[model samples]
Target: MKTFTKLAFLGIFAATGIIIAGATAAQDAPAKLGDLEVTGAFTKAMLPGQPVGGGYFTIKNNGKSDDMLVSVSSPVAGTVEMHEMAMQGEVMKMRKLDTGIAIPAGKTVELTPGGLHLMFLKVKEPFKQGGKVPVTLSFEKAGKVDITLPVEAAGPGGHEHK
Candidate 1:
């Protein structure tokens, strides 16, 4: 009877640990506001002395009307500006998007690298891996939604290679 009790106790402890780990992983899950869903929000780690940073994400609109991502703000930066990168006569040019990005109804808009993205101006501290950046997203019709963007490695690719 004593041996059986110890085995049961160990099993219960292991199950509890698994449950806690799952909850932590879900912290970065997608966020929904009305008919819109935001996912894959993250930023790359920045080197020291870097004055700017970039943020990326994907927005899905499911409503009958269009929505516009008017502005974005972050706690770690003095200001966040919407921007886009394009080719200007064989030279890559980055431009500020004063009008913001549009998310049409029943369509998906992706703010990614080398395209539409957020520019973190005058960063207080360089972003480091494993840090979470808090941001507020304002929509023309959907109002505002607060989300956290996880900081990842500076290198590209979803996962780091050995």
Candidate 2:
């Protein structure tokens, strides 16, 4: 009877630990605002003395009307602007999007490398891996959504980077 009681207590403790861990993970999951869902947001680690950085994310619009990402702002940078990289003839060029990017209804728009991304101009400090950068995204219809872009190593991949 004593051995059985000890085993039961240990099992209960293990189960509780698992439940707590799951709850914590769920709290850190991606956020959904109105009909828009933002996920997989991250930024790459910056090089030494680099004044610029890029941010990428995936935004899903589930509403009936289309929405536009108007602007992005962060306190870590002096200026944040929406930029697009394109190949013009033999040279690659980067240009700012004055009108912002449009997100059609029921579609997911990805802001990635070598494409549409946020430019962090005059970064106050270097973005380190395994850190979170607070950014506010302004949408035409969704208004404003605050999200934390996880900082990862300079690479092309999703989060969970080591």
Q: lDDT of all the models against the reference? A: 0.73, 0.71
For 2-72, candidate 2 gives per-residue lDDT tens digits of: 12243453453243221101110111556688899988776767756666777877789998999999988
Off by over 4 Å in 1: 1-27, 159-162
RMSD of 2: 17.3
What TM-score, to 2 decimals, does candidate 2 have?
0.76
Candidate 1 minimal-lDDT segment of 10 residues: 17-26
Distance from true position, residue 143, model 2, in Å? 0.8
Each candidate structure's TM-score, on Cα atoms with residue i matched to residue i, is 0.79, 0.76
Best-performing candidate as measured by lDDT: 1
